[model samples]
Target: MDARERLAELVQEKGGSLAGLSRMLGRNPSYLQQYITKHSPRKLEEDDRRKLASYFGVAEAELGAPKEKSYDANQEWVDVPRLAVDASAGPGAANSAESPFDSFRFSRKWLREQGLEPGQLSAIRVVGDSMEPLLREGDDLLVDKSDRPFRDGIFVVRLDENLLVKRLTSQGGGRFSLLSQNLSYPPIAVSAEDIELVGRVVWKSGRL
Candidate 1:
């Protein structure tokens, strides 16, 4: 069935009213009902359309009436590389693999230029401010697994095998430290062996 018809069924199954769906999508309740029941689609901006799709657990193109020529599967293909999330890599880590993502292509290119290589490099969505002013939350990070660690450079490391993005600095002795760009957060220190250097960060690009 078409998106509107499917949405009507999904809303009923989920015990969600048009008002509820409107709230979930941050849309006006009345407008949403008209769009869904009457198939009179509204001219929502792209971001709003994306948010609506995410709220409905559907694709952005499916937010309104089903468009003609909408079922071109080849046009929608994504080239995903296998990426391991270290946190979820225990016991059946192999089973919980996520589809490959293309967020880190440039970072992968930079790694290759530096002679550190991996089968593939993927961009990871940043979620914390541990890297602070330098790297904000939601910034995409390029991690190069084939590159070795350096004394003073930003790197994506798995501490005790848990993934983290921080700066590696020499602590004077046999110890190395993870430094945070934000002054409020303290640094982390550990032995070289305990830290697994997945890759050094070559470049970061994002607006505040």
Candidate 2:
């Protein structure tokens, strides 16, 4: 059993298929498969290799450990915050476990792939059905505070110091109405002076 054999075992034990591993490393699964199957000793780009190593809970050198396929997925779960299943809370709570004071490091390429513009928006977790069908509960929403109000769409608003996400409806007479997508919830009317626009939803993503 050599390094390649060890890597294969690690991947399998960690519940990482070639495709899932590819996403973490930002590489093609087919290409990785060739190297893993053929002992081709293919070199990974520094960042991608680092990410893969991190995902595997091992150093780059250890990725080649001799074939003992014992790995724990729980080791990797620590970084992710526990998400609320329903819309009990707004996007404000999704990554709330994260320290606001801690600096965040993210791949710019990944952000672009998710249709997020850096510094223009903040990410929030949706926990309620106020905006449903269009934006489901447990979805991640990106809000761009700098985005000015234009046509009607979903937006996060702060009314009376409470944060909520709702559909913005522009009515005549300089008034706006916040309507919930779910019929079960009633609409809230706001005067132009009282409404504080937090940001508009630029994009959303969710895990199935």
Candidate 3:
């Protein structure tokens, strides 16, 4: 059976309605039902397909993921969890609720070349337009959780009860100025103890 048929079968087996599954995918309640019955939009977006495959514990290829890439038998690959939380550039993502909704596969050699350890990494998406021109909405960022030294760079930080992605500069005396690339937003000064560092954004897995 094809992807649509397979998805329909899975939804049936899970004993849930298409509307419920659509909600789980954060889409309109009729999203899946229309996709299955009407086939509008022609195909599922890659992110949505990947998320469904993970949630259902199935291979992405089974959901029509471009027949999968061929990997060398000896080359090592790593799976980095893509947390389902936005690192907002504007107003922060409140409470920073997050969980691994999918994963990104990268060759082990590539990670080593970048001096990034696989175990100390996670992926998240960008939101809002504060860091525009450099980082845009929907860009996927590879975060280095182990590289937590005070430094000048784009980073994910927790301020108050919200999570944000901003450039940080040391203000000395245990203080920092959160800088935005867009410059339309003003800088925020906070003590080093007040800002919780989530990770440094090492690379963006989006268009150049």
Top-lDDT candidate index: 3
What is the alpha-carbon lDDT of model 2 when measured against the actual structure?
0.57
Could you give candidate 2's per-residue lDDT for residues 56-160 as a string of tens digits? Answer: 545455554223432332232211112221222333322212212112344556655766444344456677766777778777766665544477888777666
TM-scores for every candidate against the unseen true structure: 0.47, 0.47, 0.63
Candidate lDDT (C-alpha), each: 0.54, 0.57, 0.78
Report the poorest 10 consecutive residues by lDDT, candidate 3. 66-75
Give me the displacement of residue 35 in model 3, in angstroms.
Answer: 40
User: On a 0 to 1 TM-score scale, where does candidate 2 land against the true structure?
Assistant: 0.47
Error of 1 at 188 (Å): 1.3
Pick the TM-score winner.
Answer: 3
| Backbone atom clashes (below 3 Å) for every candidate | 3, 7, 0
Instruction: Specify the poorest-scoring 10-residue window by lDDT in model 1.
Output: 86-95
What ordering of candidates by TM-score runs from best to worst? Answer: 3, 1, 2
Ranking by lDDT: 3, 2, 1
* Candidate 1 C-alpha lDDT tens digits along 47-108: 54544443333554564524552322223232212233422111111222333323232243
Question: Residue 13 of candidate 3: its Cα lDDT?
Answer: 61
- Model 1 regions lying over 4 Å from their true place: 1-99, 103-120
